[model samples]
Target: MLNHIIGRLSLGGLLARAVSAAALLGAFGGAASAVTVPILVADVDSGRVIYSQAPTDPWFPASITKLMTTYVALDLVRQGRASMDTLITISPNAAAEPPSKMGFKPGTQLTLGNALKIIMVKSANDVAFAIGESLGGSIDNFAAMMNDSARRIGMRDSRWTNANGLPDPQQWTSARDMAILARALIRDFPDDHDLFSISAIQFGGAVIPNHNGLLGRYPGTDGMKTGFICSGGFNVVATATRGGRRIVAIVMGQPSARERDVKTADLFDYGFAQDGGNGPGLDALPGSSSAAPPDMRPYVCGGKKVPAIDEGPGAVSASATTAAQLVGGAAASSPSLALAAFSSPGMRARTLPPRAPLQPVAVWIGRSPAEGQQILAQQAAEAQAAAANVRAARLEAAKARREAVLAKRQAVQAAAKEAAAQKQAAKAAAKASGGVPRSASAYTSSESASMPEAKPGKGLTKAKDAAKPAAHKPVAAKPVAKPVAAKPAPKPAKKAAAKSDE
Candidate 1:
């Protein structure tokens, strides 16, 4: 079921006249200035516009730029240049984008399919940038591809400068251009329609819901995208099917997400009420007079009271009184609904019900499911190894400190022992030299020979005399002289002594 109808929408001429600018301004909080937002509704099958309001006016695309990003990626898949499983690495440039991001670190990788799901559901800027880099080798290159595709697809009023649509003065698109692009995406990739309808995506422990409030809130609503910035307010490109007929609705520059959602629902009600009407194709829409897109910062973000941004967890639902207060007092609580308020003669602000429970689709990082597991396991193992190395280093440092302490202790003991030995040597030298003084350096020579040595019983004065030899008298020489003369007498005496001995 593919329809390549480019664009032709019947502008609700009577309907436009009935919904006066004053009425619209009252419904939009009765601000001082009445901002004219771009809106268009067209049948997907016949490519005929059911209702339109300044659809050709240029406006900031905001995050809806991801639709073009997605188309470019899907086109790559169609041309066989890449596949869904192609791995996209989050470079430093991607990781450094502003919030509404995935916070993936530089070098973190995920399959192109997972990345697409994240950007669609989470409106993640970082992931979108990474996808651009992966597909086109750089963001500038990817933007070139986007412009080339837009021109080729008959989108007359759109320019893309960045992948994530962060505030760039150069980037803008009109309701007509966005609708045509949406039609191309739907017609070109019938099998990939589910990509736009994802309710939420489960990434790791986090479950991020899609920002498009009408997905579950509105009955026939199926797939689409929503975007917001201070300068752009809120924008949405939504599609729905009813009674075997599908239609696309584009709303841009709403004051808040609540108005954006309510207006879209009202447009859907009007679109389904009509059969394909006669009108010019999307290409025939007149270009805007202004060269630059309107800056809605004053209306959207000025003053003390700022409107609810689109990045919140859920769509804002207000009671009738609260809604009246928001839109500068319109109506009281009643049984009437806000869905059909815009198309009716009088518009009233109403509250939306709380969103349905999220049905999360699982997304993981890597080239494949098995590869993701392997990468996780490898990371765990590396973390463990790093911890072990830290422990080892600590132990090594402690051991070195203990060794130094022990070496210091040993040195102290050795010094004490050497000191004791020296002291003993000094004492011995003092005793031998009669208590003569000496230093540690005097061990090489001793004065014991010149000094007196004290004995245990004798004093130091008698020690010299005790150490001297005894003197011999002069009788030693007389004994030798008398020996010769006494020899003759001794011989006679010896003879007598011998006779006596015999």
Candidate 2:
């Protein structure tokens, strides 16, 4: 089971882990992630912490959020507002949640008990959303209830913005807070406690297994929950009973889900070994309730944290409780299947979790099963009709898109044909006028060629001839008779004789 779960995490879900790691380190200097992951182990019988590390640091809760989500639903049942058989209808908003979902269509209806099993077994985000909507009228209203529950249970450092624990930087919890939540579930809702131990739920023709690997991989591990996100690596709050001694162990900010399990198992072993003093009460631990929630996104998802971040004393992280801006950055988004590969390849478990008896929680919508089914059938019909209308609308839209495309193509072809016709008309018109439409360059060249060539003598007259039309042909000159030269010579001799006689 661990192998199956971790295989999903390592495949592609951990991309954000590295990127978020880098940003967190840079923002908080170098030592932030080293101190933020909170771990707490407590003796359930005594409500005393056996061991703790960074118990008050705030971190993302991931799907461990379902614990509170389950608590709230069970609380409603105990309050007479709802029941184990309560039918939760999937709304559009709930259906829209990302994967790790049950993919139940809008208007789909099921008993609250069955929903709990599926979510606990499969960690379905959509079902969690639906559960919240069904309970407190809306997720927001349910969240208000969750906060109230957290306060009542002394989960001092936790805040919930969603039911499924998807990425919202604002959603945070601490290891101690989770332990508190786990203890509350154990103490308040003992009958419904088995929901967390379900190994798998059969949905349709397939089986969706629980995300918690410890259930079947560790000894004496009876029940609890596991969660992961990029910023908050692998987180698990596990509990096991051995020889009548029960210990609840929490491990957070693990690099992998497998590591989270191993650490948790070890903590439980350590917890059971203690016969000594039970530590302070969970809420009585030394820490400010107002401590800001630390963001581990950069370290976990940012792809930057190394195998080892140096451990050191707290730096400037200490700030006034009122002024602390603990918006833990880069909190885990939707983890892919690759986060915590179940086991390092070929690893065999020496001790697997003890099998828990199947105990289904029964919740109700204040109606008989048959009456509920009738109402559900009616709702299903309406939903189906609505879906048909939507499909028709979509088909109409597609037809419109295709028609628009075809019309655009036809317009382009028509424009091309009209341009060709206009060109032909222009050619016919030019030919009828007996005038060739020459371009400026062509006309200039023709005029230049028609101009007469100058005689090449040095004069302003020759310069003026340079501007003549290029097309002009020079006329051939006729040869002058030789008598012009003989007459000039004769006149010159007569003039010379007259000058001599004078």
Candidate 3:
């Protein structure tokens, strides 16, 4: 090894070898610190990037992938393939999705309009999956539609594997691509713009608030979505309108929801302050170095308990005061945000004020309000019938158990009675005899009538003889055996002749 190293050192100068070693180390060191936070803010009208940081780098889309799902559903509506009144039935496949889900049972039905509302505000994974299955006939088909639409709209770096933005290795998107999708959503479906801006939605008695922290807290922050996973961190594709100007901001790979929201607010502040476009339009951004996105599990979820769903409305952290000072005390002047700042001096955590009462838009199942009521009534009746059937089955099983017990008791009693009758007969027969009666085994007969009635004296004699002990015969046994051996065998002819005579 030393000789080989020496030869290489002689071929390439010692300085060159040292430089190569240093370069390799530096590359490894850079990778160790490569935890990037991709951010982008673009004008909605002019399609220009206002502020950006590694905007073209691929990153996990997380729940924000629902934005693409919403787009596809709305596009189908535009093409006259579906309508808002379209029914989406929850199948076993959809109902089985993980949390940030509605927990709807299989066979539950709801309108496309209600499903969209639930997915937008609550980011219900199950509902999103159902929409995919209902609208596209299956999850795979819907994903195909999503990819096709994305390509058509110039989202060059985005790839979708599922309707809901659940974690998947193959699924990824860049800030630039997400911005393009947001632009397309705003431009293509202007009439349905209110869908993205919903604050909260009322499904039944529970009111589910949107996961996007900026909606109600950040002034003029109207629509868009937020997403999170251990591998992706917190992501938001947020759009805010201030002073009659609207811009879309994409923030990705933040450690927490607070940082995501604060950085987004800061970007909006920066984007609105800019008078002209920054470098280039969103489409003109350069390609990424790698196609695969970086996994953020270590930075985002390291040594911490990560939440399964998007973050909900939370109290401002204690560091809000510290962050307020960093942003130049903009929090005191406006409830909207702090100020334009992006340095990671303190992670840029901000404290948002309490949100106002949410007027959640009402959402329900079925085609119409009246029809929904009828469906509810029908479900209630079916529940009652199922309960009744269960009760009846239990009662029948109990009755069978009782009947079985009674039959078992009757069988035991009949067996006992038969034994008693046999004992009584035996006792009566013994009582009739003065002495020990002859043993039943001594004279066995199939029919009593075949044997002649014994004379009274003879019967008593036989009984007495049977009860007496036998006297020991010394030489009688040998004599009787010899006599039997000497006897001649009977001929067949003689036996037949005797039988004929009889």
Candidate 4:
């Protein structure tokens, strides 16, 4: 690492010295301590740079890198390599990006247009990754495309290692590079000019506001973006138009979002007031070492802690719609509510102006319209299958409930039969203890047929005792006394006389 810097210093020493000289010359206007960031205010139409402060110094881009990512996608669309409706499925790598993200789960589907909206409005990291993977097949391959595109456009101070602009030492960009990219984005894609101007997006019933503050507060604010990270500080690439003139402002490495917005807004104000186009060309801006700048953690997250920032209305931001309008390069843009508020004395605006809302069209996985339809159909079929599975589960649950109910009823019935048998046994015991003839004659056949259960356990025991009739007959054979006929005694006496004669 030491050798690399030394070698660059040996080879690029003259350039560094020249940059220092230029920076010293420019430092007369703004105090060095007052503005730690690299700032630039340029006239977009005349190719004029109205302000410059370490514009070429290396700085981390943070979320603003999405601009280049968006640019690459627009180029693909122009070349017919992709379309705004191109479906970008969230891959695991894309879904794994840290917060300041949409948190879309893996395999989540969205069209390129919607993805771009999420990136611009939500400053979503995951969506940016999905966009990269969709266009370049992988984030690494897409980063290669970004570098190639940057070199082609002469963004010498910029390089991209990841799409979401998460912390990476190798991934850095400069104010000048970001300005060039912002201008190119505004220039090349006219139709998408509306994208940057979008103030907010309604997602899942919640409004995800744009990070660009200038959009609704500054009268001329139209479109552009803001970014931040502990290493990057608060950064923004903003544009605004007043009357026929338009300007782009890039502010990087401020201590807070409020300071970044107000300072940049004040710079645009200063630039628009300039009399003539007198500054170096965009490509001719002075730059120092190509290596990453010093870590800003101490300044941002260390001793003097940078406050948590949310870049929307009530946040420290200039008007972004006006910056977007600057992207449109539309000469006819009028001063909006942001301009009105800026014109008002001591008016600290709380929210952005309302947007002319439009729903984004769907993008699905497909090579063509027919293929996209096919994919949609497959998704529908899968959804239907899932519904069927749910229905089947509910049905099974109901069937189980019904079976339980029937089992309960059968148990109750069996219990009732056993209870009835017990009650009958108690009644038979009471009857057997009461008076009743033991002789079989007392129970006539007709009476026995009707009163088969007169004797306790007599009827049912017939079948039971058949197995051991002799044992049962002797156990309950209690003979009962009966009245005898008088003729029986006379007969007995006559029989006794006959027996004596014999």
Q: Pick by TM-score: which candidate is best? A: 3
What C-alpha lDDT does candidate 1 achieve relative to the native structure? 0.72
Q: Which stretches of candidate 1 lie over 4 Å from their true place?
A: 1-35, 303-310, 316-340, 343-349, 373-502
Off by over 4 Å in 3: 1-33, 311-349, 377-502
TM-score of 4: 0.59
Scored by lDDT, model 4 comes in at: 0.66
For every candidate, C-alpha RMSD to the true structure in Å: 16.9, 15.9, 13.8, 16.0
lDDT of 3 by residue, 388-455 (tens): 99999999999999999999999999999999999999999888875544454344221243333344
lDDT, candidate 4, 222-270, per-residue tens: 6788888887777888888898887898887755566567656656766
lDDT of candidate 2 vs native? 0.64
Tens digit of per-residue lDDT, candidate 1, span 1-502: 0000000111112233433321232222345433456778888877777666677778899999999999999999999999998999999999999878888778989989999888888889999999999899999999999999999999988999988888999999999899999999999999998999999988656787888888777777888898888788778999999998899999877666766776677667656656655656666667766566777776566763543333444455543223233323332221022222343333434545566677999898787667777876787798899999999999999999999999999999999999999999999988888554445222221123443333333333343344454574333444333322212223443343333322
Candidate 2: list runs displaced more than 4 Å.
Answer: 1-34, 288-290, 303-502
| CA shift of 340, model 4, Å | 24
TM-score of each: 0.65, 0.59, 0.67, 0.59
lDDT of 1 at 145: 100
